[model samples]
Target: MVKMGTFFGMSLGAFVFWQSMDKVHVWIALHQDEKKEREEREMEVRRVREELMQQAQQRDSVA
Candidate 1:
C-alpha cells in the first residue's frame, strides 16, 4: 500500500512539472518570433532610407 501511494505522488509531481515546462517553452518561442520580426522591419526601414538619400543626391546633381 505504501509503495502504491509513493508511486502516485511521484507521477502527479512529474505531470505538473511537465505542464509548466510546456508553457514556458511556448512563451519563449513567441518572444523569439516577435524579436525576429522587429529586426526585419528595422532592416527594411534602413534600406528605404538609403534609397531615398541616393535619389536626393541624383536630383541635386541634375540641377
Candidate 2:
C-alpha cells in the first residue's frame, strides 16, 4: 500500500514538473519572436531616416 502511494506521488510530481517546463519553453519562444519583430521594426525605421537625411542633403546642395 505504501509503495503504491509513493508511486502515485512520484508520477504526479513528474507530470507537474514537465507541465511547468513546457510553459516556460512557450514563454521563452514568444519573447524571442517579439524581440525579433522589434529589431526588424527598428531597422526599418533607421532605413527610412537615412533616406530622408539623404534627400535633405541633396536638396541643400542643389539650393
Candidate 3:
C-alpha cells in the first residue's frame, strides 16, 4: 500500500514539473521574438533618418 502511494506521488510531481518547464519554454520563445522585432524597428528608423539627412545635404549643396 505504501509503495502504491509513493508511485502516485512521484507521478504527480513529474507531471507538474513537465508542465512548468513547458510554460517556461514558451515564455522564452515569445521574449526572443519580441526582441528581434524591436531590433528590426530600430534599424529601420535609423535608415530613414540617414536617408533624410542625405536628402537635406543634397538640397543645401544644390542651393
- Tens-digit lDDT string for candidate 2 (10-45): 999999999999999999999999999999999999
Name model 1 segments beyond 4 Å from true.
none
**Best candidate, TM-score:** 2
User: Backbone collision count in every prediction?
Assistant: 0, 0, 0
TM-score of each: 0.85, 0.96, 0.94
Clashing residue pairs found in predicted model 2: none
* Clash-forming residue pairs, model 1: none
Give the poorly placed runs of model 3, Cα more than 4 Å off.
none
Model 3 lDDT tens row, 1-63: 999999999999999999999999999999999999999999999999999999999999999
Q: What would you estimate as the lDDT of candidate 1?
A: 1.00
Error of 1 at 23 (Å): 0.9
Task: Give the Cα error of residue 61 in candidate 2, in Å.
Answer: 0.7
Please state the error at residue 2 of candidate 3 in Å: 1.4
In model 3, the Cα lDDT at residue 23 comes to 100
